[model samples]
Target: MTTDTASPIPSDAEQFGKPLQGWRLRLYTIIFEADTRAGKLFDVVLIAAILLSVAVVMLDSVEALHQRHGRWFDVLEWCFTLLFTIEYIARLVCVRRPWRYARSFFGVIDLLAILPAYLAALVPELHLLMDVRILRLLRIFRVFKLTEYAIEYRLLSRALANSRRKILIFLSFVLMVVLVLGTLMYVVEGPEHGYANIPTSVYWAITTLTTVGFGDITPQTNAGRFIASLMMLLGWGTLAVPTGIVTAEMTSMRRRPVTTRTCHACLTEDQAADANYCRHCGAKLSPYQYDREEEQPVRR
Candidate 1:
């Protein structure tokens, strides 16, 4: 008797457990998936709009420019805000669970991109927050579909995560050193030398230890100067400690090859190079293809 193997099941579904179809499916494909030409174009245009909006907000801060082009800047700001508002709504409408996505990192960022404009009348200072749209530019990494860059970013992120504990301990030690040195300076230099109190002295200690000598405060006494010299020397070595820790962690990691293929079910990217299913959602992945054109040899 001949036996047949069962075909893989499709797991793409909405929050209500229905498969996405029609316009919603098409919109999701274009908005969430960066693998297609239309999707890439959308992302590029969106990124450009974000950058221009941020520039408008920044230029508005300059008194001279604001006075000269204030009216034009206001119109441009509202135009960009309206565009982002529609994009944000489309993202919500296309996703399976709107509430879930609204609570996600990118979703929050998308909302922030348009919120400042609406609230600009209530609090004029909030208009400056429109610059947060610059964060949306991170989408560029996925839009280009550069597998190597994505892998490197993942590697660096992993190294940093693994080194977090060591880095935290190093920071704690630095904090204690600053506290002790700051108190000692306050006692030796006293209020007359600008080491007015423990907190002020701690600020000086931080600036000195970071080698950022603001020159607003100084150690007048010989004992305080000696301590400052020691802190300065210590800063040089401190700067390299975190770098070495992260580098060592990165070197010990085994780099896995990954693809820019994004999972349709959950919209996760960075799937394993040979994966047939989404690692995050177990959805059967569609055929993976390179977006870039392969070089062809010259014809004889």
Candidate 2:
């Protein structure tokens, strides 16, 4: 008999591999897994609520709208907060390791979605923090389960990670160029021309190099103008170098096929389509099937 030598990746549930059953299993499937009809529906509704809640927060920020419909916005905000509170609690209740999920990236996002509203209630000054509720929109990625997007996100993330050192070195070079240019401009333009000091000149150098050209600072001398032109030309090339590095890394890496099929045991995603075990926890995977008519996963 042939033997598979692949190792299981470590996950939150690696130590406890027992699969969930009964209603907890059903709830987990609905709330965490996005492959089934019910799961998809739950995710769609959750995403809609998230979007609406974020919109309410945004509209509430408008001074005119706040004056006119502040009370209604407050009510709607609480309603969405309560709804999310229930959902967050459900997620905690359903997961085998509640703390694990609670501490996970999305878990913290889920909590943040509800906490700011309550905090705002206790301390009116904190009302501005309600804007953080917009982070809940990040859930759209998990909910939509677009395989192509998932693959691309992984690719981009890996490319960036692999090229971080090179990018860092490039940024250091840019920083040095900015510092040197800023010092030169300060010396050339002096205080009367608004290039008062090294720090202020460095700020100008950054703005000029990025092409932001805020217009608050101006080069009074021909040398200063020439330096600004050099910085602008250098900026264009500097910006493209990082992109090329990441693109090369991405192109060199192999793309692997993945699915939205989630393991009930560990909650690790991006499982292979035909795999019977969780690649992260080695738990037996539940049978995989999706509605053929709804094969295209929802996009954000």
Candidate 3:
């Protein structure tokens, strides 16, 4: 009798190795997918660390506090820096396309977040560069829970993109107005009245136009004062125009279809209700069903 002696097929874990299927994949999911429980927990922990690091930086800026707890602050800074370094490395390793993650906006932010500590560690003389660590406050963006409002960000981005030309034109007009007012103020006030030069007058005009009165240079003449008053009034009204434009665009955007199924691959949550693929990354939105009973295993 002829015996069929066939070896068993390898599972997905055995076939592709551990990198794509086991704990590595689980780590990727926790790190990258916000919808999952593990992922949410990971984000919570990350946010807490970010907040503590930011608070440490803020406290270090206070001279009294720095004097008393300088050593503790330094230790905490290094700890937070090390934690972020590990996270950054893990993120780079877990993603299938490390280059893509490295080039992304969050990736750049993450690098900036940890750079100061390393810079300080390598070159103690470069302690001045530690001020760049203030940029870590941008981590508040991740903490504000704004990531959950994908639609608002998308709508606002679209509105801003659409309004860019109009906003540019408005800014150009404002600049021309500033130049004319500055020249007039320089001619009227001259050096004695605190208008030292055309540039200084222009600076005063800008400050008045923006309603940011510094009080270091003020128009002593009736004409200059009148112009300042007019500019202040104009500034108040000018601020409303940009707001109205964005509001109109947002209203128009409300008509578009929206969905809550965030793509685990690219974090693109602004898909349509019926979308089967992510609009941003083209990743599968819905899970695929497999009929394991009818499928034949591959012979090894």
The local distance difference test score of each candidate is: 0.72, 0.72, 0.70
Worst 10 residues of 1 by lDDT: 140-149
lDDT of 2: 0.72
How would you encode candidate 3's per-residue C-alpha lDDT over 44-162 as one tens digit per residue? 88877877887887788788998999999889888988898898898787766676667766667677777766765677655465554454344334333333224355457667776
Candidate 1 per-residue lDDT over residues 146-243, each given as its tens digit: 22123355567667777787899999999999999999999999999998899999999999999999999999989999999999999999889999
TM-score of each: 0.67, 0.68, 0.67
TM-score of 2: 0.68
Clashes of 1: 0
RMSD per model, one decimal: 10.0, 7.8, 14.8
Candidate 1, residue 197: the lDDT equals 93
List, residue by residue over 145-220, the lDDT tens digit for candidate 2. 2321233555666677778878889999999999999999999999999987999999999999888899999998
Error of 2 at 21 (Å): 4.6
Model 2 stretches astray by more than 4 angstroms: 1-25, 100-104, 123-163, 246-254, 259-271, 274-300
Q: Which residue ranges in model 3 land beyond 4 Å of their true spot? A: 1-29, 95-104, 127-162, 263-271, 274-300
In model 1, state the lDDT of residue 145. 25
